[model samples]
Target: MEYTELKVWKETRLLVNNVYDVTKAFPKDETYGLTSQIRRCVVSIPSNIAEGCGRRTPKDSIHFFHISRGSLYELETQLYLALDQNYIQEKEHKVLLDQIIGCKKLLNGFINYYKTLKTKQTINH
Candidate 1:
């Protein structure tokens, strides 16, 4: 199963791209601050998802999913900070935020699905 085939992964990838694009316009002074932190957190979301897809066991994969979820929340907080700092305009903030929220929901759904699968596997084994 290719990671790109997962909707959650694909959506997170888009979110990461948006983060990179917007952070490009941030003040140079924040180059090593919020900008760097945001880039790392957003990248973690999809990167973890992809890594999870390659894990040898369902349980192992789910661990990566949890990591990805944590990264998403971190990204959200950083985005809010960016908004408060006026690094991004309201319109840009809204669009990026909406995307982040949607991606988070999708990640949650996938996590639940995988947990259920692991439970069923345990019961049968």
Candidate 2:
């Protein structure tokens, strides 16, 4: 399946866009610090998913999905840090948190679905 067609990818893609929009108001000093870190982490979530979908083997694809999950966790942490540092307002933080939570659930469902298929393939082999 094309990664672009997947709801998980689409949602994560929106999350990335939101991150970019929200991070713009951060302090200038954070441009190379918290801002860059958050951007990298958020970007990886969707990029990894797309990369995984391009892989020929199910195992390879699943591995990328795992990486994508890790990135999501990293982004979640960064969002909290952003809140604590006052880079984002409470409402903005809540919005981003909601988006991240939704993306994580969708990504988890996709990963579980692929894992089940992998298990069935292993059994049939």
Candidate 3:
């Protein structure tokens, strides 16, 4: 399946777009610091998903999914830092954080399902 057609990838792409929009209002001083870090983490989400889908094995796909989840956590941390530093307001922080959490949950579900399918195939074989 095309990565773009996957529910997890679609939601992740939305999360990344939301992150980009929120970061646009950050202080100019953070351009090289929080801003860059946040962008990279957000980008990693769907990038990892796409890379995983291109792989030859389900194991490789699961590995990339885990990496993407790590990036999701990284983005979540930076988002909280942005809120604590007053770079983002409480409402904005809550909205983006909720989206990040949703993406993580969806990714986790996808990973579990993929792993289960792989295991079942191995057992059958």
Candidate 4:
């Protein structure tokens, strides 16, 4: 399946875009610190999903999804830090946080479904 066709991938892409847009307005002093960390974590969301999808096994896909989840948490933490540092307003922070949470839900759903499929295949075989 194409990466674009996956709901989790699509949502993750959107979330990453949102993070980029918000981080663009971050304070100039944060160029090498919070900004960099936040960008990397945001990028990891879709990157992991694509990497997992390219793998030969469902277990690999699930592993990448788990990694993506860890990145999502990292992004969330950075977002909160940005808010606390006054880099982003509460409203913008909340919106981005909501998107992150949504993407996480989608990723978890995909992981669960993939695991279920793997289990069924094992049982049938």
State candidate 4's TM-score: 0.95
Each candidate: what lDDT? 0.91, 0.93, 0.91, 0.91
TM-score of each: 0.95, 0.96, 0.95, 0.95
Q: Which of the predicted structures, 2 or 3, would earn the higher TM-score when compared with the native?
A: 2
Model 1 is weakest, by summed lDDT over 10 consecutive residues, at 71-80
lDDT of 1 by residue, 9-98 (tens): 999999989889999999999999999999988999999999988987779989999999998888888888999999999899889989
The residue-by-residue lDDT of candidate 3 on 36-60, one tens digit each, is 9999989999999999888887888
Instruction: Give the candidate number with the greatest TM-score.
Output: 2
Deviating ranges (above 4 Å) for candidate 2: none
Question: Which of the predicted structures, 1 or 2, would earn the higher TM-score when compared with the native?
Answer: 2
lDDT tens digits by residue: candidate 2, 1-125: 57799999999999999999999999999999999999999999999999999987778889999999999889989989999999999999999988988998998999999889789889989
lDDT of 4: 0.91
- On lDDT, the candidate that comes out on top is 2
Error of 1 at 121 (Å): 1.5
For residues 1-125, could you state the per-residue lDDT of candidate 4 as single tens digits? Answer: 79779999999999988889999999898999999999998899899999998988788788988999999999999998999999999999999989988988999899999899779878888
